[model samples]
Target: MEAKQLNIGDNVKKFRELKGFTREQMADYLNLSVSAYGNIERNKTDLTVSRIQQIAEILEVDLAQTLNFDASQVFNITHNEVIQGMHSKVENHNHPDEYKEKYIKMMENEIARLKKLAGEA
Candidate 1:
């Protein structure tokens, strides 16, 4: 769905409920009143960048996912330059030719690289 069509507040509310939290509980976690939190999820209130960030963290999700933000448009705009840089860096790295021939080892290395890029490792 288009980012503009997606309701960020609705996504947040859905996630909170899926995690078994009531509006009061989520409000308590965010140091907001139940009425304020209700407004947020209902999109009756405006959420600032800092508030959205805080909500993303509390929900343990990325801002893009929380907002249903379309990231591909952004990436596409920068891809020519950024992908070129990544390609050059990858080429400079010395990996074994024999390792490339092995499926398991290559998969492991790919996973490691992805994790590192995502800051999960």
Candidate 2:
């Protein structure tokens, strides 16, 4: 199987959406124009570590998580099982559902926390 490529821009976009932040809000917070912020999400900008750190801080996510976010693993939990020819994937394994639920809950909590922080700020 080919290794999946990680895209920091995509991850940043995901986190921003999860936090219920609009592009305008993010751009304003970063003192950037909307088009400039859009470039970041489109992977048109070559991001530096400092920029990545700034984005992570703004999104309220850990730098490591932002750098390492894998959409396939998170969204396609049965990928490995399918590759192995396991036809009874969902029925045979409840892990995916549990994991997805937990992940959703975690994101929800994070969103709430960010909202509270924003209110405070």
TM-scores of the candidates are 0.52, 0.55
Q: Model 1 compared with the native: what TM-score?
A: 0.52
What lDDT tens digits, residue by residue, belong to model 2 across residues 32-114? 99999999988889988888987877665678767887544454432122212223322234355655665688678767988
**Index of the highest-lDDT prediction:** 2
Residue pairs with colliding backbones in model 2 are: none
Worst 10 residues of 2 by lDDT: 78-87
Residue-wise lDDT of candidate 1 within 22-97, one digit each (tens)?
7876687678999999999998887888889887666555677678733232222111111221222111213333
- What's the CA RMSD of model 1 in angstroms? 16.8
| lDDT of each candidate versus the true structure | 0.59, 0.67
